[model samples]
Target chain A: MKAVLGTMGDEVKVFGFWASPFSRRVELALRFKGVPYEYIEEDILGNKSPLLLHYNPVHKKIPVFLHNGKPIAESLVILEYIDDTWKSNPILPHDPYDRAMARFWANFIDDKCFPAFMKAVMGPENEREKAVEEAGDCLKTLESALNGKRFFGGDAIGMVDIAANFIGFWVRIIQEIAGVELLSADKLPALFKWTDEFVSCSVVKESLPPQDKISAAFKARIDQAQTNTRP
Target chain B: MKAVLGTMGDEVKVFGFWASPFSRRVELALRFKGVPYEYIEEDILGNKSPLLLHYNPVHKKIPVFLHNGKPIAESLVILEYIDDTWKSNPILPHDPYDRAMARFWANFIDDKCFPAFMKAVMGPENEREKAVEEAGDCLKTLESALNGKRFFGGDAIGMVDIAANFIGFWVRIIQEIAGVELLSADKLPALFKWTDEFVSCSVVKESLPPQDKISAAFKARIDQAQTNTRP
Candidate 1:
């Protein structure tokens, strides 16, 4: 899809937040490709560094990857770039049609799954039930995409699976903190299995943060949501 | 990015809506690559054909590009697939970083511009102003992407330019039909200029619909929206 030759001299820097699935997506690609990169954690919630702003002036968002000081914004864009530059451990399928399918589903996950799943857990009380139903429908569709493959990329973590990191890892913690469960073995067995398979992957394991850290961050989020919702 | 060898025997079928930017994107890429294909105009706003349903079972949407019976859905996905399969008239840049930027801006057009711009034109009266502000902001950012280039692709119509077909052509008609002025020479000179440059290209001119036809279609849409908005 997109990479460069990974070496000590390669000027690879990742501007990311500790908890953003977007930033972790960049790290996952680099690690999967065995690319060494200097990681800079951003104060995403408070103040982004001037450098981060400079790199991604338009979006000014995290998961901005820099190669030789040139910035690549958007995590999926960065993923493809890494895949192309490194040439090894290809994230996208070689076949063009399959690659298109991968990109489509990856987009569906980001554009559909994230919002619905997040709302199912974190949205207003009045809307949570509807979001849960919507999120379940999305999970059903996603489970079908597995089609008995071990991963969306088939037998390994690929672009679609990486693009779905939020549902795999963060949702597990966030849903627990919010006392909601939209994704489960009973409802979406394939996706449920994928969650474990993805997070347990030796390569993905390194990119994931401690579960407790995620729990604490989301716990604070829940408290803030409750405070904001209070009359 | 992607392509195929085009000839009489190649079974390249495009299931598209005549006025849909998404479907038109697929057509634009094919025309750019000199690929020969059958174009089936779908009744997208009505009952979608069984073939369209069968081709893209997941999204059940238009711009389904079928190559020798293999289906590729999503306009952007199909666009890249066309670029890869054709091999001639490359739609994407060869450089990995440039390719990534192209992908980013393409997604930005579909994900950000379309929704914001559409809402500005078609949403409820109360929401139109906010959407106008939002759509304006979005256009400002897009104008920056031009960055003095004749097109987002530079010198010729490329992925970004083709991807922006909606804003380049449809908006000129839609905004006028909706009695709104979101994009204009005075407001966004670069994007304003890009619209003409993109649509006037011989390759794109073949794909665009007649202005009267677009006017008639959207005139009906505005009437429907008004009826729905009435007490």
Candidate 2:
């Protein structure tokens, strides 16, 4: 697999925080492309790294990709930059329509699914049922999109799959902490199978943080949220 | 200019509502590309067109671009598809980093600017001030991104410019109705000038709805929202 432009020694670095799904998305994309780089973990909740602040002044969030010392922030945009800059094992489909569809789904997962999932986990007690219902609907919609395909991009993992990394791994852990079953195998068989396959895929298998660590992080977040709301 | 892949006579259609900034973004992109498309206005609040519902079942929202009978929803995604499918007068910058920057700004406008603007208009009386402040911050961030560039892409209107269509025209009108001035020239001088130039650009000029109609529409919406919440 030849480098897209053979600027072989160009520095490629990723600024990320462990347990952040968005950060994992970028790391997964870089790994998929076989791009080597240093990964700097940021203290996102505490004092954020000054380099992260300098690189991503607008959002100041990770994962910011630093290529040849220039920064690119936002996980989805970083994924596109990775694909465009280093094209080995292309993650996006070639057809214009297919590419658009992939982007559309990725945007959907980001804009709709993530929020709904969070609401189910963190909404007030009275609204938790509605939030769970909405989250379930989002999963069902995603399952329909998969339609028994091997992956969201069909036959292999691609951009949409990476964008939806949470559904493939994080959701179940989140559900466990929230004491909900929104994405159970019985509820979304196709999606569950896809998740299994996605998590086992070579690069993704190594890229994801261990489940116990993620579970502990989530518990801490939920506890902190509850503590903040206590009057 | 030759068509990218000469699917001559391809049926390109746009399902949109006249007042929607998102819809206008897609229309402007098509016009810039010199691609002929039939625009179907959906009665979004009344009875949504079955076609829109069918095409964008998940979101059930407007700005669905149907190319050769396949529907692609999400305005930014549609813009990219239009650019990829019709290569004339390319709307996105060619460099991958530039493209990523364009997308980052576009995503910023969508994820940050639009929400803050909405909060300014429709938030509770107590929260309006905070909302306005946040919206102003978003504008200042956008102004910084422009940084005296003629357009977001430098020298020409491009994807980021198209994605920020709301800020270019809709924001001023929305400000008038909301009785707040978040995009004032004194505060956002660069953004104000960009908006003036953007709205007057040949393609964008024709794509936007008439000012009087949009003003009346927004007024009605704000009035109705207030009426609904009255004690």
Candidate 3:
């Protein structure tokens, strides 16, 4: 069977949870690329629907992208698929080396900053400061990567920015509730500027979750963490 | 400047350490694609070379691929770059969905299996058994993803196979030194068979480190873990 390339008439659906950063990556990619799709919200915090299970038995996580009827899991993989399928507003750089660099930074965001951010905000009280320092180091490295450019991908936002939506939007809200200071203009001015530009973009501005809802959700998480860590 | 989409005359070089499975991924890819290049061995166990640091300052890890002076780091990113540059052998699947699946499982091996395998072999004494069980589960999930196919990418070894090189070759050696039993013909028959088939391929066979050297290398690692854990 011939592989169906991206057709405007393709049946594209996204299985995603409301507050997942990974799911938001997929959403931002679609919105950035001007693709049309139906959104199916999964209650991932509670029970994952049978449909999600059917589509993604291995990971059983959200942001499962379906083109026609086939499912693609993993946010990075789905982002690449979306780019491959729809070539108009490119999610990646045209140059192979540039594409490789974009991928490297995107994975860096996932592997380094996200973990450090989680640790800084929710780790044991004794280790919180060290985790904050480590998280700052990761952000500083990332800031260097930004390198005076308007975005990680240069003038326009690309996959790296999409991968970093949490850093741009979610962290600001979560940091206040968690009493952690990781991302801000004083420490990482370039990244802070990029976040401002990224979230301000209409495509991102309209889709980012409501500030109050995210605050409520993450507040519950911090409360849970504190309860769990009680001496 | 026009992007160089892989010219046969392009200067290619691979900076890698001998025992690293990630570095080996890049080696297998170049050999499988029949791309010729210079190999620079780095003494990663001791001190890293200035050149490696110069090329990849961010991660400062090996398996830095240089194509006409531009460096690409991160094993998976380098794999994609190689595939993108050279059109002949096609490192990734042509079909977009199939490509997505390949990327998904490749990352699964890295993200899920690698750490679990490390813990199984090198973790503290009491945690070893549970780590082994968790490692087995990861392998079992990977086995299911194999899905009766001769290779993870249908009949041929692809990125997933390359990514699982540690599982295929390194784990078999490391497990013996560490005195653990995880991957085997009885437990995961398909993956066992795939490993046999994978290593037998001339390209993989020739590039894979000699068993004696790997055994010696991993023995030192296991010994180091024992020393560190001896409180």
Candidate 4:
């Protein structure tokens, strides 16, 4: 309920789309940091928020974290800001190598894995199998990366774990929306278990929007897209 | 030249491909840090380096910065490691927000710009235009992000600058090889200037491989791919 102001003491605000996974990542980071933030939901596909545009002139995309007056675009960047500014429970590890490891995996998820998932979601129907295969390869790599750690950072949740949380929650919903299972329990058991533990965390559990609502919103969007023939 | 060993202070070695942009990024970072590292050039596409495989069991790619014994993978991650361990001239800004900003742009370049460039490089003749357009969009965003800053970290070159240095040098060569003009002086004047300045920096200038060698290697790679597809 707290207003999220910019770091320079400009009024902090988050311009986010309700069902966006990227937006959710920022929200979770804020909640974990226990930082006060004002959330302004934008109808990204329909109406653009002036605040979003003003804050993120380049990408003009949500979720844009406006601290004081300076706007930090990019979910991963915003998350790091929250960790740095708040410094309550550090989201990134203290040791540089450990921190680098966390960042490496986080980057892996953002750069490699997310694209595979997106392809599975948006590729042509005939290419679904190929997309699924790509998604599987990405997931397999992720599974190996976990290394029997409770979270990607081991035991406690860290930046990499938070970044990869999309795999746990959104990936399932996306598979459902796209009608393909990418992370079956049989195939990615560690990742599946990690997802359960990740969402079960009090901070994450509290921050998550209702699943039914998200599912409904996604389905509606997909239907609209199918009807419109535009991406 | 000092040996660039892993974190544990084992025999320091780097398994790299002579012409790989990613490998060169690490090599430059190491040289900047004055880390003595043995450079073992690998035939990456045909024959894998045993050290590369042994060091980076997960990715099996370079530039793997092997400190005494521990192997660190990912060029960006290795750059950070080199910066952290050596602490010569810091590659990243001290301010976390600035660091995050640098990281965001770097990630943007790696995830968006590089992929677009690759598409332009490998696409069929008919798809070249679309690929170029995609690459242009990415370059424009990068230009806007620069906003008259000398380097991504304002005055000094940092991790983000190193990550994006490829745009200045390799991109032009790739453009030459692919016969596509994505980064013209008119379209991305700031970036063009930045690239010139970046490559001219004493450390970067000295570390860079010869342009003729790079161009030949890249052309050969493309030719090999084309030949492999011919029936």
Write down the C-alpha DockQ for each prediction.
0.85, 0.94, 0.89, 0.55
Scored against the true structure, residue A25 in model 1 reaches a CA lDDT of 90
Give the number of the best model, judged by TM-score.
Answer: 2
Q: Which is better, 2 or 4, measured by TM-score?
A: 2
What candidate 3 gets wrong by more than 4 Å, as runs, is A1-7, B1-7
Ranking by DockQ: 2, 3, 1, 4
For model 4, how does the per-residue alpha-carbon lDDT over A1-231 read when each residue is reduced to its tens digit? 122332334465788877787888888887777666889899888889777788777677898887767778998888877877777667888776787787778877877788777766765556656867988898998888888888886888888878887787877886798687888889899988889998899888887778889788777866664455443
Return the lDDT, model 4, position A188.
94
Error of 2 at A115 (Å): 1.2
lDDT of 1 by residue, B1-231 (tens): 233245446899999988788888888888887888899989988899999999888789998999989998888888888877788888899988889999999988887888888778777777878988888898899999999999898887899988888899998998888888889999999999999888788888877899899999988987787667655
Q: Give each model a TM-score.
A: 0.95, 0.96, 0.95, 0.86
How would you class the docking of model 1?
high
Can you write out model 2's per-residue Cα lDDT over A71-97, one digit (the tens) per residue?
999999999988888878888999888
Off by over 4 Å in 2: A1-7, A226-231, B1-7
User: What TM-score does candidate 3 get on C-alpha atoms?
Assistant: 0.95
Show the lowest summed lDDT stretch of 10 residues, model 2 chain B.
B1-10
Where's the lowest-lDDT run of ten residues in candidate 4 chain A? A1-10
Cα lDDT tens digits for candidate 3, A25-100:
9988888877888999999988999999999987889989998899999999999999888877888999888899
| Model 4 residue A152 lDDT score | 87
